[model samples]
Target: MVSAGLYWLLSLAFLWGGFVQMGYPGMAGEVCIAFVICLFLLRFILVKRFVAASVFNVAATVVFFIFIAILQAKGMTGVA
Candidate 1:
């Protein structure tokens, strides 16, 4: 139960981040993709698939950094 709750919180945070990033001109579609990935992460956690959830979480983190790097390379200056 505690683990599930923690995972839920993390997923919500990711969703919130995605929403906040949606206003950036080149980021809307990427944010949507992140939202979907976070949803799946939430589903995996809720279903007690810890292994899959962990794997997804790692993959999501990697993908997120990749996106950030891409944005930086594209000269996106704002943190928003």
Candidate 2:
């Protein structure tokens, strides 16, 4: 139950951060993507898939960053 709350909070944080970063020009997607991948690996190895919350957090982070990247690539800097 606590883990689930943490996941939701982290997911929202990531979404907020992604949009904030999106406003700035020349933000590299590679770094964020790498971080997300690492988080996934860590969650899988350490958490052992027993906690579904972590997975949702990671997935939400990844998806939000991807969306930001797509928007940035399309020159939507001001949209954020």
lDDT (0 to 1) per candidate: 0.59, 0.56
Candidate achieving the largest lDDT: 1
Write the residue-wise lDDT of candidate 1 on 15-52 in tens digits.
Answer: 67667767776765465446668657565565454556
* Position 11, candidate 2: lDDT: 49
Best by TM-score: 1
Error of 2 at 63 (Å): 0.7
Worst 10 residues of 1 by lDDT: 1-10
Give the worst 10-residue stretch by lDDT in candidate 2: 27-36
RMSD values, in order shown: 5.2, 9.2
What residue pairs are clashing in model 1?
A: none
RMSD of 2: 9.2
Over 4 Å off, model 2: 1-51
